[model samples]
Target chain A: TKISQPWKTTITTDESVTPWEDATQYNNFYEFGFGKSDPAKYADRLKTEPWSIEISGEVSKPGTLHLEDLVAPNQLEERIYRFRCVEAWSMVVPWLGFSLADLLKRFEPTADARFVQFETLFDPKQFPAQKSSSFPWPYMEGLRIDEAMNPLAFMAVGMYGKVLPNQNGAPIRLVVPWKYGFKSIKSIVKIRLVKEMPKTTWNMLQASEYGFYANVNPEVDHPRWSQKTERRLPSSLFTPNRIPTLKFNGYEEQVAYLYKDMDLRKFY
Target chain B: MLKSRWVKALLHIALLLPLLEECWQIWLLVNGMPNRLGPDPGKVILEDLATVAIWLLLLGLAITPAKQIFRINDLMRFRRMVGLYAFTYALLHLLSYLAFILGWDFSALWEDIIKRPYIIVGTLSLVILAALAATSYKAAMRFLGKRWKKLHQLVYPAVLLAILHEWWQAKEAFNEPLLHLVIASALLGYRLVLFFNKAFSGIKNQQSLRQTARKNS
Candidate 1:
C-alpha cells in the first residue's frame, strides 16, 4: 500500500496524542453495545474486507466505489486532531486519512447539492447493538456542502500508521475536525449529495440536544450536562486534566468563515 | 443472625466489600497494574460507587418486606448495617464526583447542583441518606423515638429520586437505568401493599366486633 506524506506541517495539536490502547478500547460506538468497551470487544465480527461506498444523489458520478479503488488514487496523511465527545470528554488522536474534499470532488457534486450525508454499514448479524432500537440503526451524519469541502474535513482509513481496527471503523470513516466526534460517522457505506439538510441520527433522535451542525461550541451546552469544560482522557485518579473547551474546538481560524452571518447558537 | 458475634462480623465485612473493591482498584491503578477502571478512571470509579450506594439502598429497603413475607426475623439484624453502608457509599460517591469530575471546584459544583436537574436530584437523595444515617445510631434513635421511623420513611422518596437521577443522566442506552427504576418501584409497591392489607384487615375486624355486640344485645 502506498502511503501519503505525513501531515506534520498542515495539521497539529499541542496536546499529547492519546495512547493507542486507550483510544481503541474506550469508545462510544453504540453499534457494538452501550458500554464504552463493548465496541472493542465485539467489533471483530464486522467484515471490512469486501467494503464499498455507494455514491449517490445529485452527483454526476454516482456509483459504488470499492475500498481499494477509493484509497488507491488519494494520498493518505496523518492528521493529528483533537476529538471532543458530546459527553464532555476529549482525546487528541493522530488520524491517517485524506482530505474529504479531495474524495468528494471526484464524484463531481451538482450545484443542487447543498449538503453531504454519510451512512454507516448496518448489519444486525455483525453489530449486536443494532438489534436494540436505542437509535435508528445505520448511523447517519451530514455536513453543509462548504463544510464538507473544508480542508480539515477528513475521510480516515487508518490511525497510528496502521489500517484502522474494526472497532475504530475499519476500511474507511469520516472525520470532521471542527465538529463533535459523533459527526464523524464510522464504517461509512454510502455518501449522498443532497439539496436539503440531511436528517442525522443524533439530531433525529433528539433535535433539542443534538443539532444538525453538531459543531464543537462550548457555549451551546447539551441539555443534560455542561460543555464548558472537558476532561481530557488518560487523566490521573485524583485530578482530571480538565481544560476549558474552545469554540469550534480550536479550529475557528479555518472554519469560522464558513459559518459567518449564521447564528451558531440557533443552528446548534 | 445478630445472636452470634461471628455472624455480625461476617455481615459487616460483606457490607464493606464494595468499598474494599474500590480501594483495591485504586491500589492497582496507582501501582500501574491492568485494572478495570478505564480511560477516565475517575468517572468510572464515581459511577461504580454511586451504583453501589443505590444497590445497598435497594437491599436495605427490601429487608422489611422480606421479613414480613418469609418470616425471616434474622433479616432485621442486617438492615441497620446495610443502611449505614448505603450512606457511607453515597458520601464516597459524592466525594469522588467532587474530587474527580469537578476537580474540587466548589463554584462549579454549586453551579452543577443549581443548573442541572439530575445533579439536584442526586444531591437531594444524598441529603436524605445522610439524615437517615445520622439517626441510625442508638442515641439519635432514642431521642427521635417514633419520629425516627417517620423521618426514615423519607428513604422511599430518596431511592425514587436517586433512580430518577440515574435515569436522567443516561445519554443513549436506558436499559440499566430502566432496570433500576423497575427494582425501586417493586420495593415501594411491596410496602404499599402491606400498608393497604393492614388497613383492610383492621376495618374487617371492627365490622365483626360490631356484629358480635349486636347479637349479644
Candidate 2:
C-alpha cells in the first residue's frame, strides 16, 4: 500500500489542492452507494489487499496480475490534476500514479485493440449498493485507444502523497484529467482491450446525458443542468467560488489534439 | 382540543424544529465546521429546505380532509400556522439558492431560469405561496371578502407546481420525487372528489325542486 520514493511530475497544476479530508470524504463511488458520503461511510468494508486485476481481450500478456506485481516496476509520480465531476463541481488533487501508457505498453495490446474497457470489483457483500438494480453493477468505463495513450492518462494508486483511499478508488484507478470525473473509472478489477467501442456505465444508464468521450466542455450543456460553470470545492456560502468551466477541464493544450475535427457538440 | 394554549404552543414548537435545524446546519456549513451536510452544503441546504417546504405544503393541504375524515375540527385551528410555515420554508429555499448557490448572482439565476425551466415552475409555486401567506391573516381575509375563497383556491395549483418542480428537476434517481407526486395526487384527488360530490348532489336537488314546483303550479 506504499508508494516508495514517489517523484513529482511536470504535467501538474499549481491550483490549490482540495483538502485530503474533503477529497476522501466526498466521492461518487456508486458501488458502495450514490450518496456523496456513502463511499466514505461504507468503503472500509472493501478488502483491497487480495486484489488481482484480470487483463484480457486483444492483449498478448492477458493474465491475472496481483496488485503488487501490477504496480511494482513503474516509478510512481505525483500529478496535481483538476478533477471535474459531471455534476458541475470540481477539485484539484495531487494524485500519485504512473502513466497508463506505460502500463498499457507492458500489456502489449494488439493491432485490434481499439478501445480499452475497465470494470470495477463486483462483490455485493463488500459493496452493498451493488445489490440495487438501478445500475448495472460492476461500474464500467472505456477510453479510445489514442485517448488511452495520451500523456495525461494516468493509472493512479494514491493521492495527496498517500495510498489511494478505498472511498477514492483504492488499489488502482484510471485518472483521465481531460475528461469528466466519471470517465475516469475507479476500483478497477478488470482490463479488456476491445475492437469496437465499449459500453460505459453512465452512457448505458443515460446516453443523452453522458457520452463516451465525456470531455469537459462548457459549450455542450448537459440535458438536465448547465455545464457552463463549476463550483470549486471548499467554497464558502458568501464566496461561491464559481468559475467558468474550461474545454477539456483546462487540459486543452495537452489533450485537445485527440479530438481534432470531430463535432464535439454531437459527440457530447 | 386545539383551543388549549399549551397544545398550540407545543404544535408551534414542533413545526419550528426543521427551521432551527436548517439554520444550525447552515451555520456549520458557513463556518466550515465538520458536518454531515456533505461537500456541497449549499446544494444540501437548498434541497433540504425545498423538501421541508413541500412536506409542510402537503400537511397544510391535508388539514381540511384530515378534519372531515377524523371528525377533529380542532385541526382547522392549526391550518393557518402550517400554511405560513410552508411559505416560510419555501422562501428560505429560494434564498438558499440565491445566497448559497448563486452567491446573489442574479445573472446566473436568470440564465438558469432561461435554460432550466424547472426553476420557473418552482418560482411560480413560490409566488403563489407568497400571495396565500400574505392574505392568510384575518384582516386580509376579511378585506378580500368573497374574493378570499377564490384567491385561496390557488393553493391547489401552487402545490401541484411545487410537485412538478421537484419532478422536473429530478433527473435520474426519481424515487423521492415519485413519492411526492403520489402523496400530492392522493391529497388533491380527495379534494376533487369532495368538490364533484357537492356539485352533482346540488344538480340532483335542483332538478327535484323544479319537478315539485311544476306539479304545484
Reference contacts preserved by each model: 0.70, 0.46
Candidate 2: tens digits of C-alpha lDDT, residues B47-119: 8899989999999989999999999998899999999999999999999899989999999988898888999
List the candidate 1 regions with Cα displacement exceeding 4 Å: A1-9, B1-3, B201-217
Could you say which candidate leads in DockQ?
Answer: 1
Runs off by more than 4 Å, candidate 2: B29-32, B199-217
- Measured on C-alpha atoms, candidate 2 has an lDDT of 0.90
Instruction: Give the DockQ (2 decimals) of all models.
Output: 0.71, 0.56
Cα deviation at A40, candidate 2, in Å, is 1.3
Give the per-residue lDDT of model 1 (tens digit) for A47-117: 99899999999999999989899888877788899999998899998889899999999999999999999
lDDT of 1: 0.89
Residue B67 lDDT in model 2?
96
